[model samples]
Target: MNKAQRLLHILMTMQAHRKFNLKELTEEFGVSKRTILRDLQELSELGVPLYSELGVHGGYQLLRDRMLPPIHFSDKEAVALFLVAESLKGYPMLPFEAEVESALKKFYHYSPPSTKEKIEKLRSHVLFHVQERGLDTPYLTSLLEASLEGRIVTITYEAEKGTSERDIQPIGVYTASGLWYCPAYCFRSREPRLFRADRITALKIVEDQSRRIDPPGYDLRDWFTGRPSGETAELVIHLTRAGAVRAKSDPLLAEGLTVHADGRGCVRRAAAISDLSCLADTLLGYGAKAEVEAPALLREMLLQRVNEIRELYAGAGG
Candidate 1:
C-alpha cells in the first residue's frame, strides 16, 4: 500500500483495537519496526495523539485528552477523496454531508503540493454520471456497516408509486451504472432481493436478534464483482445505418452486441442489458434509425414512448 493508504489503515486499526504494539504494527504492515516507528511519529506530528506506552501490555494509542488534526493524504488519496465528495453531492439523502465536506477540506489541505496541482487537471479529465436521484447515502452506508458486523437494519423504502417500511439482514452493497444497491433478505417478504439505494428514505439499525436465519450463503464479493445474476436482460435490436454508426461510437451501447446481416444496417443480439429507459433514450436520440426487433414487449414500450413524444411535440409550429 501507498503511504496514505497505510496511514488510513493504521488509523482504522487503532480505532478498532484502541492500541497496538510496535511488533504487531510492523508485522501487520510488513514494514520494519524502524519504518513503523517513523510513521507513528509522523502521525503524532499530524496532531494524532499517538502516545507510546511502556512495558508489555501497553503500546501506541491516541492520547485520551487531545484531539487530533486530520491525517495527511498522498496525491492519489486526495484525488480519490475529491471524487467521492463529488459523488456524495449527487445523493441528497446523505445525512453526513457536513462531515464529508469537512473531511474533503482536510484532505485537500494536507495533500502533497505536487498532487494539489494535479487536482484541477484530474477533475477536468475524469467524470461520472448518475441518473437516479434522492439516493439515501446514510441508509446505504448503514446497511454496509451492518453487513460487515452481521447485524440487522430497518429501512423505509419507497416502492414504485407507494412506500413501506421493512426490516432486513443486508448481505452486501452492490453498484451498477453509477448507482449503489443493497441485496438483503427482507423480513417482511421473507426472500432474497435487491433494493436501490435511491429509493430508500430512512434507516435504523435493529438489534442482532432480528436476524431471521444465518445470513444467506451467497458470496457477496462474487455477486457485486460485476453484474449480479438476474439483473440483466437479453434483447435483439435492429439498427439502421445511422443508428449503427452512432451506436458503434458508444462503448456502453456496443458492449455484448453481436451484429447480424439485415436489409439496411444490421440486427444485434444483446445480453446483460439494464436500464431500458437509457437504452430507449439512446435509440430515440438516433431518431427513426433504431428500432427494437425481438422482445416484442420492449419494442412496443419504446414505440409507445416515441409516439407519445411525437404527440407532445406535434403542436410546435414551423
Candidate 2:
C-alpha cells in the first residue's frame, strides 16, 4: 500500500482502539516505531484530534467526540483531485505545503476503495521526478497572497550575475519544466520580468496599492506552445529510447517530438526554449541518451559540457 493507504489504515485503527501505543501500532503495521510516529504527526497536522500520554501505561487516544463528519467525493472528482496532486510531485517547497498535503491525504482517505486502487495502479505504472535546484522559496505563500490582493512586495533576489533588491507588482506565478517562476512587473525596471521563486532570498509585503498599474497580459500557454520571449534557435535532437521516454512529460523537451515507426524518435524543439542555460541543463540531464542533431553552436556546447563532466568524474574510484 502507498503512504496514503497506510495513513488511512492508521486512522481507522486509532478510531477503533482507545489506547493504542506506538509499539502496538508499529507491530500491527509491521513498520518501524519512527514510521508510526510520523504517521501520527501527519495525522495531527491534518487536524486529527489525537492526544498522547506519557509512560508505558499511557498511549495515544483519538478524540472521537470531536471528530469531523466524513467527507464524500464522487468517483470522478476523487480521481481528478488525485491527478492534480500527482502533477505537483516535484514542485520544491510549495507554499502552505502542510495544508496542501493534509488536503491530499484526506482526499485519499475519503476516496472509495475501488477509486483508490485505480489511482494506485496508475501511479505505480508511471514515474515522474525532478531534482530540486540549488535554491528554495519558503515565502511563496506570502507572495501569492500579495499578488491576489494587489499589494506591492519587496524582494531580494539572486540571479546568475549577482544579487539585487526590488519592489514589484506581482502579476502571476507559474511552473515551467520543473521550476517555479513569478512573472511580475518590476517597479525599478518598468518591465515584466520572470523571477525564479527559489532565487527570492527575502520577501516583504508592502502596503496595499491604490493605483495599481495593470501588468501587461502574460500567458504561460504561449510559452508552452513554443513561443518564447527572446532570442531562440531552431535546433533538433535525436532521442535514444530513454530520452524519448523522459521527454513525454517535459514541457519543452516534449514539444515537436516525432517518433518514427522503427521505435526511433527525435525532438525538434530548440525554438521552444527562452533560456539557453535551461535548455543546456535539460540536455545535460539526459546525458548521452539525447543527441543534439542540429544547430552547430548548441551541439558543440553540449559536447564540450559532456566532455568536461566526463573528465571530472573519470578518475573517481581509481
Candidate 3:
C-alpha cells in the first residue's frame, strides 16, 4: 500500500486496538520496526493523540479523544450536511461554536470543486432567517453541561421582579425564536420553571452529593411536545382576516388557530393560567383586529395594560 493509505489504515487500527507495541504493527504490516516508528511519528505530527509507555509491559496507547475513522459521504449527503451546519449560523450563540466552525472548514476544504461551487451558490440562495438577539447568554454552555450531567446548579438570575440566587436541576436547554431557555426544577419555587438563559448572570455547579435529587420523569422533549401541562383554562379569541394573517406570524398562537370559510379565524385552545398575561400582551398588539371572546381574566389584564398606557400618555397629547 502507498504511504498515505498505510498511514490511514494504521490510524484506524490504533483506534481499535488502543494499546499496541511497535513490534505488533511491524509484524502485522510486514514492515521494519523503523518504518513503523516513522509512521507513528507522522501520526503524532498529524495531531493524533498517541503516547508511549516504558518497560516491557507497556507499548503505545491512543488517548480517549482520538479522531474517528474516515467515512465517505455521497455528494448529496455532503451538501445536506453543509446546509444543516449553515442553518446553525442564524443563532447568536452556540455551545461549541469553535468546533462547528472547524468542522465546516474541513468539509469545505475537502469537498470537490463542483461541490464547493454548489455550496457557495446555495449559501447565497438558501437562508434560515432568525431574528437577531442582542442579549448575551454566556452561561449557555454551563447550563447545557449541567443538564446532561443531571447536576444541580446555583445561578444568579435577573427576573422581571428582581435578581436572586436559586438552585435548580435543569432538564435541558433549548433555543426558541432567538433566545435560549432552560427548563429546570427550581428548589426555591418547588416547581418546574423556564428560565431565560441570557438572564442568568452567574452560575456554578453544585457538587454536594447531598443536594442532588432524583431527576424528574419529564424532559425537554416532553415540555416542547405537550406544554401547558398544569391546570389550564380554555381561551377563545375571535380574529379578523388581517388578525388571522398576523397571528400566523406568532409561533405560540398560530398552532391553535383555526381559519373559517371566509378568511376570519379563531384561536381556541386551553392555555395554562400562568400564560394568560403573556397572551394578553400578544393579543393587545393586534388592537382592533382581535377580540377576546372568552376568559374574562385575559380581558381584564388587557384592559389594565391599556389603562396604564393611557395614563402614561394621558396629558401628553394636550
Candidate 4:
C-alpha cells in the first residue's frame, strides 16, 4: 500500500488491537521493521496514542485515549469533512463546535501533502447553499453536540403560541430549506418535535439527568419512514409552477413526497403528516402558488389557516 493507505491500515489495526509489534506490522504490510517503526512514529506525531510495547509480547499499540484524533481520511474524505464543516456555517452555536473545529484542525495538520493540496482545490471549487437570512452558527453547533451526546437541551423556543423555554431532548440534526433543524422530543409535550436551528436564540445544555427517554415505542427512523400514527395523518401536497423547484430540492420533502413536473411548477404527494400545522404553514408560505391536492383533510387544514389570517387582518391597514 502507498504511504497514506498504509497509515490508514496501521491506524485501523491499532484501533482493533491493544498494541502492534514492529514484526507483525512489517509482515502485514510486507515492509521492513524500520518502516513499521517509522509509520508508528508518524502516527504518534499526529496525536494518535500509538505506543511501542516492550518485553516478549510487547509491540506497537494504541493507548486507550478517548481524546485521540481519528485516523486520516482519503482524499475524498478530506474534502467531505471540509464540506460538512463549512456547511455548519449556517448554524454556528452548536455544542459540538469546539470538537468539530479541533478535529478538523488536527485532520488538516496531519493530512498527507497530496490530500491537503486536493482539499485546498476542493475548497476553492465547492459552494454551499447560503441562507438569505443567516443564523447563529455557534448555538446550532452546541445543540448538535449535546444532541449527539444524548444530553437534554434547554432553549427559549418561539412557538406559534409565543416564546417559552423548553427542556428538549434533541434526537438528530436535520437540514431543510438551506437551514439546519434539530429533531427533538419535548419534555413538556412528551412528544416528538422539531426546532429550527436558526430560530433558537439561546440554548443551554440541561443537566437534570433526563435522558434518551423516547416514547414507549418511538423509533425516529421508523416514524420518519412514513409510519401511520393516531396523532399524525398522511397529507399529500401538490405544488404549482414555482413550488416544484423547492419540492424537488428540499431534502425533507423530497424523500417522503413524490414529485413530478406538471407544466406549471410541480406536483408532490406524500402520506405522512406528523406536523400538519408546520406543513400547512409551509404551503401557505408559497402563497396561492401551491395546493394540497390529496386527502381533503389537508386541504381544509390550509384553508382554515387562510381564513384565520383573513379574519385577523380584516379591515387592518396593509
Q: Sorted on lDDT, highest at the top, how do the candidates line up? A: 3, 2, 4, 1
Q: What TM-score goes with each of the models?
A: 0.51, 0.54, 0.80, 0.62
What are the lDDT scores of the predictions, listed in order? 0.68, 0.75, 0.84, 0.69
Which candidate gets the maximum lDDT versus the true structure? 3
Higher-ranked by lDDT: 2 or 4: 2
**Candidate 1 residue lDDT tens string, 1-318:** 988879878877886677789899998999998888888887776557677779878888776546543355566877777777666555454434465666566667667778877887777777666556444456766777777777778889986548999888888776654567787877786655677777788888786664546735655764434452334566667677667766665534565444546534544544333345556655667668776776665676688777887888886642
Q: Best candidate, TM-score-wise?
A: 3
Ranking of predictions according to TM-score: 3, 4, 2, 1
Q: What shift in Å separates residue 69 of candidate 4 from its native position after superposition?
A: 7.1
* TM match of model 1 to true structure: 0.51
Pairs that clash in candidate 3: none
lDDT per residue (tens digit) for residues 132-210 in model 4: 5556544776776776667888888767778889888887776656666787878877666777876777888776764
| Residue ranges of candidate 3 with Cα displaced over 4 Å | 1-7, 20-48, 52-60, 65-67, 209-217, 227-231, 307-318
Error of 1 at 305 (Å): 5.9
Error of 1 at 258 (Å): 2.8
Model 3: residue 61 alpha-carbon error in angstroms: 2.2
